[model samples]
Target: MVLTDTHTHQYYETDPVKKAELMQRCLDNGISRLFLPNVDSTSISQVMDMVDTYPDNCFPMLGLHPCDVKANWKQELETIYAAIKETKVYAIGEIGIDLYWDQTFLAEQQQAFRQQIGWAKAAKLPINIHCRNAFDEVYAILKDEHNQELRGIFHCFSGTLEQARQIIDLNFMLGIGGVVTYKNAGLDKVVEHIGLNSIVLETDSPYLTPVPYRGKPNESSYLIHVAQKIADLHQTTLETVARITTENSKIIFGI
Candidate 1:
């Protein structure tokens, strides 16, 4: 049973000892393939370093997160884009519209989102979206960019079934995270109905930790909890869930 965490910030653990410990836990639990997303220019080194350390286990993605859009947003994108040539990135994301933190940079966020979408198309790579409180805004752009070469995962998805349908319609996959394990998150309802092919598992650690460990910090190793919950929702075994989702991840990341 090989579990794939399609979206995770596992690079946040900087300590060599702790990093190895968490990674061992993940591997011990059969969670070997972890795809890392860099938030902005600052996190590129960390994400790449972690991948460098565990090349066979970790994969890299570079993007300017929506929340990271600021007055110097253009400069940040330039830096991120320039670095793209320096490394082989699997995707161009966790980038999308985010109005959850602040609505102040809405326009900048939209422009940045569109710009990144262009990059994704040009490179023929999948995207890892970071949408929050801006589904309509994000979907509008996604719909406009829909094409044969346009594809990606909607990271940290905690939305309605209707939204899931809309996303899957565009040949994209829903990135189901720890939120699905939250008793009151309502994502389990969505997962229960959506086709397994349209879903992929994620932890978004060290945030959105699953139940039994909800109140504490999260790690990629806890991906089993998320997978177990989904298996329960789908009335299947953990191995089935892991296999289908990991295969779906391969379809998206092309690995």
Candidate 2:
């Protein structure tokens, strides 16, 4: 079975030996397709370097993460916007509002989110959004920017049924990750309510590791536990979950 980690940050490893070892673990686990999201100017090189090293297995996404939004966001976006043209950007992503950490850059985050949405639409690329404690703000921007050409995954979605419906109504897929495996995350109910078609799987690795590995650094290789958890939640099989979610990832990334 082929599992696609629609949102993962495998580029965090700089050592060639460690990187290869980690990627081999993912490949052996059948988590073959790794889509890496960009955080800012600082992350592009690492992500792109991984993409270069594993051209087929690893892919790059270009965008300024919400938490990285600062007073110099305009400059960062400009730098990101320029780089998208020079490389093959799989998506415009990991972008959205984040009030959980700091609200000082709320306005700038909103502006950056909107601008990146425009970039995604113009480039005809899907987006992998990162939202936290600012769903209302993120939803508002999405509503305003809604269009036939606008589509992507709501990365690491941990919201209510109403929010899930609203996201699906926007023709976007919900990116289910290790959060679903948490004992009290309540994402199983959300998954059951949304059905499989509107869902995709992710690890958001180096974070949100699944049960049995919780509290440790997450790896794409541990994705099988996540798929198994979703299968248990849906009363389906791991193969079924893998097949469906992998197809959903292919559709969104156009791979």
The whole-model lDDT of each prediction reads: 0.94, 0.92
Q: RMSD of candidate 1 to the true fold?
A: 0.6
Q: Write the residue-wise lDDT of candidate 1 on 81-107 in tens digits.
A: 999988899999999999988999999
Q: lDDT score, residue 174, model 1?
A: 94
**Tens-digit per-residue lDDT, 90-149, candidate 2:** 899889999998999999999999999989988899988999999999999999999998
Winner by TM-score? 1
lDDT assessment of candidate 1 = 0.94
Backbone clashes under 3 angstroms, per model: 0, 0
Pairs of residues at least 3 apart in sequence or in different chains that clash in candidate 2:
none
Off by over 4 Å in 1: none
